[model samples]
Target: MRLRSIVLIAALPLAMLAQGRRNAPPETPSTKTPAELRAEYIREHYTKAEYQIPMRDGVKLFTAVYTPKDHSQKYPILLMRTPYTVGPYGSDNYAGRLGPASEKFMREGFIFANQDVRGKGRSEGTYMDIRPVNPNKRGPKDIDEPSDTYDTIDWLVKNIPDNNERVGMYGISYPGFYAAMGAVDAHPALKATSPQAPVINWFIGDDFHHNGVLFLAHAFNFFSGFGRNHPPDGPNRDRIEMKTPDAYDFHLRTGALANYDEKYFHGQTEFWKELTQNDTYNEFWKSRDLRQYVKNLKPAMMSVGGWFDAEDVFGPLNLYKSAEAQNPGAKNMLVEGPWSHGGWARPDGTALGNINFASNTSKFFQDDIEFPFFLFHLKGKGDGDKLPEAYVFETGRNEWHKFDAWPPKDAKWKTLYFHAGGKLNTAQPAEKAEAFDEYVSDPAKPVPFTPYIANGMSYPYMTDDQRFAASRPDVLVYETEPLESDVRVAGPLKASLFVSTTGTDSDWVVKLIDVFPGDTADPQPNPTNVHMGGYQMLVRGEPFRGKFRKGFDKPEPFVPGKMDQVAFDMPDVFHTFRTGHRIMVQVQSSWYPLGDRNPQKFMKIQDAKAEDFVKATERVYRTNSAPSSIQLSTID
Candidate 1:
């Protein structure tokens, strides 16, 4: 796991164990020249700047090279390619230097390089959102990410100094994705890579859609902030903003989902179009899969993620597995922490808004692990102290556990069957003819994610709080008996249920949670029960828009009231359901503004005319004929 800059920004003490390379000594007045001032401010930290680097197609990507200024000796080049501009010090500012972020990397006697990918930042080319794939029309598959990385590395190895000829790539979020892409056709000098919170796939496992349902808050927030029309080279823009740019709040106050979409999407939301058009696992998505590429990389790799990471827990886990299966020559490992999306690195690893994580996990990752890993790989020292295959934090017990592989060898795959009347046990269904639970999902009034926020951004992408829905009359809640011993669940979670809906089509949201018993001892001042004790909080949840259940790109109307088997794989999880904690699953029709309201009609979701939006009733059946159950990757 790596330290998140978000946490680093807030929690880092000015004098706390300074994990970075020692700051250069303060110079006397006469020694501080204008160049020194620029260096001190930025350039000195990053000592080299090389702007034009030609890729295979002759497209020159803008690159900023930062080298350790103090050491005249050669060093390994650490590369980071990003769509985000290789800022402040480009061609115009000829004196090559490191930005504050690259200073730490440069100090360790390694060449730090940040480049803009083909279409974004300073690079030349039209920016495509995550570079989506198209049918075989384009030229040379349009010089994909992998090729760009391959060309960049080839340029770095031959041109840079510190002649060891070894290189490593690392980045977080979008850049993290570039790191993964770099490993596909890795250069001989490319020895290692760490993809922190990378975007592996857009639909199946990203901030946008999961199990066919749209992740409304994250998707809309992302698009509105970093939409396609963003200028390729310009001043950094506000990627994260609290308020919506448009006057859609007026429509929201009107309390209508239809009106909001019409005004915001200009009646044409590409997001809506993408979601509805790709209802099944069609070629549109198949061409976009990076697993084939991820599986083939040879670089020694690490996948870092956070349990509470609202952004990308799914991508890391899937990348780890895919790489493990495909890249036999590489050493693969995963590090997960108790923090939120990209939480491992952030300071104040706490509950959203008011919650707190007892301790600062981010500091530990940066100082003790992340920094060291890069230092050792780039320098070829400290390799003897490399960690085990997996280092994970078990939340229930609140301790770190190391294993040779994920899911720990001793873990036994266990199954807890869903029984009648909100009962979950290992026993088979007792009733041969069990009835189904039904709920009405109104497109007008969908379920709110939490009790607090009205229409603000919700954390539904990560934690699955089902308490509000459990009490809802329309939802079906099934829970397992309190654990006799601490039960640890690791790896992907799948739910196979026999479901039916009354309308032409609808959606189902299934959530898996570790329910903490109510803590009656409330703490005052910090009242509002802020993290004081156990409350039925969510662990993980995923939604499946029913029409796309059969496939993501193809939409097929549901057979109303007919029992159809449905399944969705939850993001991988590592949790210890403590002795007294209960595991619960809730099935419902809508999760609202979290997922765009699914019109009960079967038509293409994007082309879903404003009038096509309708509410409908859905049912989940559990009987001998259709024994609905959730299959978890059991770790005994």
Candidate 2:
């Protein structure tokens, strides 16, 4: 089975942004599709041209430019730089739709440009994964992402025909990283930037790793296709063909992490090799941290991400915060919606799996937030200053909320403590001599992150029902009674776990859930025949490697049967548990193939032998002296 196709269909937002029809009268559906109409429109009104734009370093990068044929008026340029192919290569071959994920932009007549980053596609140069930003460049050869972007914008504004000097950059996922880079040393013409779900740090909390834990399935599937080498003009390599359809079985059967290279990669994938070698947070990973380079941002900035983005949830939040802190008084804004990875770019954001968000959240972002952002900054058409500092979607409430600051300063911090009888409450637990919950974490039979069988990271898994996990013996479940009033959680969650393992090391997985009332009504269609009543919905979940409990840079072993602290902050959430809903917390040691299984020993996990994989009993203390709790930032 080729897992790449499955992952692409699930994770990527391939659908073109549908033309808004808010106030128009309903008409008969036409035979011509939206894509066809877009293509026709582009062919008639736009002229496509390809160029090998030269960088400061003599190397030339491939860029595709689309200028409006009706060049009677000057227009601002909207640019997108991506490692992914800027295909439909020839000048005659125009993209069906263009311009920062909206058809409106294309129709409104902005000069759109898409470029193949250095070393990818037709661009000249070797590609470095998450290329580190160079703070000091004495010569032309000391090139980085920021420098490349600066050069690209400089070339576009100077060489492009009949164009306004102003420029805006935007991209999703990998391209989003490039968009962020464009803002660092922004050109004089570069006025606006929106890095939607950008790739921030790979080793810390991005696509591959989260809190020092490798997201096994995501890393494997992504590397299978993207990690392979590509010639300057040759076709990219295909994804690996696996014998089994079940990724869980395949990964478990593959045994140790070392076996991956020996059996499949065979050291051909340089990035995977680097990942295995740098098992701990070291100089290699730290150098690629984008947060360190967010200082002195010049462009008007807007960082956008989904609250439940399966990938890069940590990126936009941290990127926004970093720019805000590093570049004081800069035009920095953040917009987080109730969608998946790049879901805001898709046509529909009404629902994910069985969870209904109750509105077209994506349309709202594009029309009201994103489009206006670019228009105001790049064209000086709208009042961009009217936009809030933070525009976030309230999940359970299914509504948009604007805040002067993220995690609203007025929001109170509350702790939900675990107690006997599987109870969770804000009140402190009463004194007890021996208060704890214990479970066996077996490497051979690790708990699956999702109940469904999938070959890669499932996009809907972020909000999938958690009842399947809650019923497991390995997962310890604790919940508060139906809330007396609505509980609104608005910011990051901190898990303060007092744990002990029978072995030297372990992994700690914490999940926040919303349990619906038993009498809740099911949806009308119910095609999947899902059970609505008493449904345990997963709001947010994260895995932490026990060794990194003290610090990401430091690794320590847990003394057998000795209590140790394993605390970490999870990504922010904007969720509300209604009055009839119960707030649940589930704690487990292993999340299976979603996160690579911990060897339960202190040695480097990437280099651990088969003998290191052992079963261990894990304990979560809930006494008056050593109580385990989750700190939540809540709004009134």
Candidate 3:
């Protein structure tokens, strides 16, 4: 990639999205893929520079800046602070793919900056996981993401030549977490930021755990490489070789959680040990949760996430709500789409698995929402009115909705009660008063999150068909006959269950699904055996360790055969169950590998042995007195 050639490509806009977000789009696709265009544009128009920027704590963090060659005008600095390395460390070398953010910013012309936060990558300093914010900072000695960001911004405005003082911050996942923190006590130059898929709460709902159930596969696999506490020289890890392709076989054969830790991971992974030790939602975990300290937020902030994101979906929703509630009248916006983790930042978001969204959702969001947002705040190129308080995509229906507030003012709360004979309806449970559905959940045969065999957590499983599980005897399925008309759901969901276990402890896995018509046509450009017809698409599902039913901080053993009220919040929902589509709900005890087996015992899970694992008779009651139901907010 030559500089002259790169400059030519950058000067000439790419066939797709070269024109900013507002104008007409090409009817057909471009000859060059977006990735190709982005690469060429970066090589030609942008010159890379590596710097070791000093933070307030006097630690020099590694930073990379991509400056547009067109020096006719100064541009706003778009910064991303991440624990992920700032690679292509030299002036001659450039990143393989500059990520989705590059596509928009390259043509639009801005000073794109990517930095290695505190300790990871080529950066100097000790790295901490979800570094605790020093709420009562007295001096430059108290360091955190916000302080580091402030110091970085201060340096950039002072040191970087030919640049506007105005700055914008953005990142996905861990970087998103940094972006959110940067907005707090932001520098005068820091104007706005977007935290896409930020990790807000690990205990409540995030990557590490969800509702107190350890996402074993994700925790083990991710931490094996990412969770290490490297010496200043740095710690590098090779990707773990899989003993088997199927996680079920691997985890099951390992016998118990502690056995696997002792044999493979050992004490090498620091976070795993911390995770195992801090089993409850104690202050150690609470200190890292970002929601507690997101007050007096500076700058215009927009939190973005995917409705189907398996990891960190709870982040943007809760982060936005907290910021909004605490600092009302602030331009705290929210955008959720039909995406996986960071899916909106990709090229194609028209479909995932067998489902079709009927539009290039990724592009639509980048152009219509994200691009406009940065342009308005950073460059004053567009009116801020283009951005809304809440811009949510209506899945199933495949449309966009703008609201002054989420759960639109007219949204009505409706509870679909679980009834006998596997029926679900707005009508209260009218099954036999003494009726209950029972399934024997065995640790030996834990229910697979997906029927497919894979070593790691599958993001697609969030929307994967549940027909396999629904058919299993260990699982119970209930559904509405068929929707009378299109029912658009727009807000959070609540699962209220009356359950009992023969064992002292158990796990409850609930799934909300959409059953397609049996005659539904298969999606285009598809794979064989998709079975779109009669497919059961999972909309939202979560697992709760039965002990957490009391609270996350404390664990209570379930008395045998004693049915109790168990209710928890499902992340949130934004889907339409179209006319002729059946709304189904499934319940079971295990989602193996994805969620650790509960062992059905009262003992400490972190130290549980093979002998502790047992089979349990689980019962879901829909009796008149103890009706189990899921409450949803709908737009009529």
Highest lDDT: which candidate?
A: 2
- lDDT string for model 3 (171-198, tens) is 9998999999998888989888999999
* lDDT of each residue in 115-149, candidate 1, tens digit only: 88886777876555566432242564357777778
lDDT (Cα atoms) of all candidates against the true structure: 0.68, 0.89, 0.85
Candidates in descending lDDT order: 2, 3, 1
Q: Clashing residue pairs, candidate 3?
A: 6-44, 7-44
| Cα RMSD, each candidate | 6.3, 6.6, 4.5
Using TM-score, rank the candidates from best to worst: 2, 3, 1
Pairwise lDDT winner, candidates 1 and 2: 2
TM-score of each: 0.84, 0.95, 0.93
Evaluated at residue 255, the lDDT of candidate 1 is 44
Clashes of each: 31, 0, 2
Residues 114-161 of candidate 2: C-alpha lDDT, one tens digit per residue: 999998988999888889988889999999999999999899988999
Prediction 1 global C-alpha lDDT: 0.68
Model 2 stretches astray by more than 4 angstroms: 1-30, 229-235
